[model samples]
Target chain A: MYWNEKHECIPREELEELQLQRLKETVERCYFNVPHYRKVMQELQLEPEDIQSLDDLKKLPFTTKQDLRDNYPYGMFAVPLSEVVRIHSSSGTTGKPTVVGYTRGDITTWSELMARSLVCGGAGRDDVIHNAYGYGLFTGGLGVHYGAERLGASVIPISGGNTKRQIMIMKDYGSTILTCTPSYALYIAEVINELGMKPEDLKLKVGIFGAEPWSENMRKEIEEKLGISAIDIYGLSEIIGPGVAVECQDKSGLHIWEDHFLPEIIDPETGETLPPGEEGELVITSLTKEALPVLRYRTRDIARLITEPCPCGRTAYKVTRIGGRTDDMLIIRGVNVFPSQIEHVLLETGYAEPHYQLIVDRKGTMDTLTVMVEVSENVFSDEVRKLEQLEYTIKNELETTLGISVGVKLVEPKTIARSEGKAKRVIDNRKA
Target chain B: MLKQLSVFLENKTGRLTAVTEILAEYNINIRALSLADTSDFGILRLIVNEPKKAYEILKKDGFTVRITDVIGVEMPDRPGGLNGVLQVMKSEGINIEYLYAFLGTNGRGAVVIFRVENMEKAMEILQEKGIQVLSPAEL
Candidate 1:
């Protein structure tokens, strides 16, 4: 719960020495072997000799998501295509997807990081892991799969969907560690209720949920329903997927692997590195990656850095709960709002359900905000007047919670769209 | 006495008007009504004239109908009139959740429709107190 300056906890001279050694080798590997790296360095008027240590990373050009898209399929691969054994692509919801390639050694390193993540969540050799993250191009599924195997635990690659079958396997296998997106875990809990099954019978001990940002309120809900300690794992396909950082049992924040990937928080507007505990965009430099080494990649995720040693004895740097993406922030009537803020309001309002949609429209020059919420069954009553009263109560509570007036529309339960992966929480009609 | 009527309606907007218009066409009066509406389904409640004949006519017109026994009680038009009824129900352990009122003839009294938690207990207590329960005809 408390944060200490971990990087300073260690001798600064020693940390910098270690970083310089890793930086030297990475630069040598890039200049001599990778054509893309060589071309980028030459174009930026830089050489391996000019980059003496990790402190000189600022001299290098920063990589963006658009850079990956520009390279397309194999343009970013540092080695020959035959040396690459695996490939993964982004969700491609916004634009053309960025593709990543990994060599056999790269996978081994990935497995090791994932193993560390599972161990951080207290998964040992005897544990049975139910891996429910979506498979194929997404790294969540296979990323957890190899990690569980490396940890010498029993791995069940459920690969998502079919809640009934997922439960059957979970109950039969006695899964101790659950791995999937947080939304899918909630969906599985819903199925368990529909089938009239008690959660105590599942024997799940821990859950590693990621792939999208979630609030602490969601963690408590999942824990209460499934009777498991849910932990957050943060990653992206471009940055070696779900093993980038993980929550220790303390559940304070996720521990980023500083040795493997260097993390820096930068102001999105000024592009200057901010000090620890300051909220800004996360920029990462892969110190140990081979086949496709990324230099100062801008992740666009907004989070504050915690440089403290965890009670669980992890000395790595931790990042606060991901506030949201810089791009996902919406401007409604000139008020900057993130979907997480709406989630916070809904969770605080005990009468409102999580199944709500934000409707945004432009009325001439100003933006209008309307929230459509599905009434929870606990508030349902036989009297029509009470239903209307409940609607008014929700409207007032939300207006007070968000500091902005919003129209509240109550709808029947189970009328909203459901996703087994990444729940769509916003509906902006202004652009449409 | 008691009055109960069932009004039939389709699952559409303004369908309730059609049912009310039909009752108006026959000069039959309505005291109260409750409606349960789903997107594509609806059930209408009514306390109207000739409850039995209305049910038969509505059923003949391809409308589902049902009937319930709702008592019309006459009470003094004073402040404690409704309080006196509630006090008795509370003593008898009966809860009234929802209710409606009907217009009474000049200076005589008013009729109230109550949906109580325990209907049988409420009727027994009122009958024992020598209170008259009006039938649909009085309305």
Candidate 2:
């Protein structure tokens, strides 16, 4: 079941030695080649030799998303442009995009991590991986494509969209493994229902869903609807794409490939690193990336790290599913709200589907939140009073939980725009 | 037994039309209808020629639809006529959830569709009180 036992399940002492060696090499590479790292190290009066052990990692300066953006195209790259083999950019939905370059060795390392990622999900050479993650600059599609090929699996690089054609190919090609965002997978299940086909009819037995924050409730919904084991794969374009970590068959938490990317959870407000199993912002240091050697890149993604040995037996540290991104949180009338929180509420109430959009608007100086949730077909009621009761119940539950009043707008099924990659579930119309 | 079609609708511009259009496609004639809207959403109650068929088609089209038996009671067109049936129901300990009326026999008489807490109990109380409860055929 293990893909790379030498690295994936490396002995603790040996893994630490390898990490320290790699960290030292990376620090030396960055300090000597990349001016950004050199300036930061100089500002701290620190040298490459100063980072003696993994514990001393705290002494080094932290790199951030803002720093990456400041670098723009290739300012943060440790290697020369001629040596870099591939380049990928962030989604840039928020602001200016951050670009990353990969040397040939970096690509091989990424592919190997992805192979280990897929193997963690129980996908093998015999499995037909229908990679629905979008291709091109996003890094999800090509990142996973390389891994599927590396794992000796047949990859259907269908990319994203064409839900009908996806199902047709999935059935005809006997695709055993499905890879896409969880919401898109749910949409596929909805389309399958619309086509009057049960999940039992499909050959798909497992799913690789991530690239966005999703809830446990959503995971269960996807699993039951698709009749497959839906596993969450965690990764970011800044650190690496979808193979930075993955949940093993245990379905407990995502096991980070500590051999390559070292994970540290820190208090978002303070720079102090939190203890294991404490939730905070994630900071990653790339041990193997050659072209883009990011040192303690603050991922902005919120998650807790678990050092406990997983039942699946991989010794790599596990990250409890990402809670939400620091940048993605919405402040409504002084109350912080996350779309995932609304999703969790709806699913818990059993009144709405996984699809929903949080619309924030403003009148004068006061900000207002309007939650548009699609009514689940299972709970749709013709009785106006019952529907009203359900609506008020949901609104009250949200108000009590969120500590702010919100307008609940019940919408029809399939009305929310389906995402091919990451589900865009928030629309903020208030003035910035 | 009188079949009434209840359709759930969002209080949007064309949602009512959307439901009507589905019924129209099935050639189901809506004899009388009442819309109760509460800002966020609305419920369209319909007395159609083929209530069961309308409910089935609307349900198939992904609309929240239900077919329920509502007793249609004939009342005098004059004021206080509606109160006569309510008084009897209250006296008989029968609870009325909701009721709506429409002109019957060219505005000569009024028909009140009673959706009660217990349809059989309300119907029995109405029948025992010598009130005329119209059947599906009469509508």
Q: Best candidate per DockQ, number? A: 2
lDDT per residue (tens digit) for residues A152-213 in model 1:
89999888778899999999989888998776787788789889998987989899988766
Chain A of candidate 2 compared with the true chain A, TM-score = 0.78
Docking class of 2: incorrect
* Candidate 1 per-residue C-alpha lDDT over B75-135 given as tens digits, one digit per residue, 9 for 90 to 100: 9888888777777778878787666776577666877877676777789888888676776
What is the lDDT, from 0 to 100, of the residue A427 in candidate 2? 84
| DockQ of structure 1 | 0.03
DockQ, candidate no. 2: 0.23
Q: Where's the lowest-lDDT run of ten residues in candidate 2 chain A?
A: A331-340
Could you give the C-alpha RMSD of every candidate to the true structure, in order shown?
Answer: 17.3, 17.3
In angstroms, the error of model 2 at A71 is 1.0
Please name the candidate that would achieve the greatest lDDT relative to the true structure.
Answer: 2
